[model samples]
Target: MTQFHAYQNRNPASRERYPYLLDIQSDLLGELRTTVVVPLCPADLAENMRLSHLNPSLEIDGRRYVAMTQELAGIERKRLGKTVHDLGSYREQIIASIDFLMSGI
Candidate 1:
């Protein structure tokens, strides 16, 4: 999957809490079997949390979901379900968040 493509979470174990998984994997690794993703859980669940840079708030399908960037993971490409939408509008914020995670700048 291309970068910033939000996908439905197929796993029932965490579906309620994390309805979407934003694929942050670069398009350059198309041949790779695994893709990196960050879960998007309901922002209400994280109402008390204040780590904006680490977990930016995002709105998808009319619901507010927080990007759980700190929980980034690599899973099988097939694991991601149907596409939610392209997060092109949030690209800069996402990139900056990733940069902050890596360099703290």
Candidate 2:
């Protein structure tokens, strides 16, 4: 899977946990074992949590969602399904979001 690609959570039980997930795993890791993901949440929820919002907002199947930078994880590749959309155009913002979460600066 490509970095910055967003995928829908197919698991019904865990869908509420992270309705949408962004693939932040490094492409350099060719043949990935696990996909590093950052959860995308509704704009209001993101604002409530004070998490960084994915600039321009991400559109998945015509619906807009903002990335919750602070909520990140790595899940087995097998668990992820098809690509829902890609955030490549917002690369800088996405990277900055991660940096902010990591360094708080």
Candidate 3:
């Protein structure tokens, strides 16, 4: 379900069309974890990074600390992008897949 594979499944149109779906998928996954009583999944965490283009910073005793290097952010972004694109029927069956992930947590 890489972006290339997603592209192969749909019309050869601009990314604007599919990026929204990606956003929607990402947002829903995020909201579910933050608002629900259920546990978060690795996939949900991955999608959060993809949609937000940001990864978690450490927060020990309520003090936040992010990597000072920009290259770290770039590396995380690339990793998340590849992960989101690698899933099966990502948009169509996101919730079910997410539920499975939640159950595993």
User: Which candidate number maximizes TM-score?
Assistant: 1
Ranking by lDDT: 1, 2, 3
lDDT of each: 0.87, 0.75, 0.25
Model 1 lDDT per residue over 1-105, tens place: 888989999999999888899988889998999999989889999777648888888888777888888788999999999998888789988887888889998
Off by over 4 Å in 1: none
Q: Which stretches in model 2 have alpha-carbon errors above 4 Å?
A: 53-56
Task: State which candidate, 2 or 3, has the greater TM-score.
Answer: 2
CA shift of 59, model 3, Å:
39
Decoy 1 TM-score against native:
0.93
Give a tens-digit lDDT track for model 3, residues 11-98: 2352222221122223334423221111112332334333221222322223332211111111122222222232333333434334
Residue-level error in angstroms, candidate 3, position 30: 11
- The residue pairs that clash in candidate 3, if any, are 1-85, 1-86, 2-85
Root-mean-square deviation of every model:
1.1, 2.3, 15.8
Clashes of 1: 0
How close to the true structure is residue 13 of candidate 1, measured as C-alpha lDDT? 99
Displacement of the residue 42 alpha carbon in candidate 3, Å: 20
Best of the candidates, lDDT: 1
Instruction: State the local distance difference test value for candidate 2.
Output: 0.75
Lowest lDDT sum, 10 consecutive residues, model 1, at 46-55
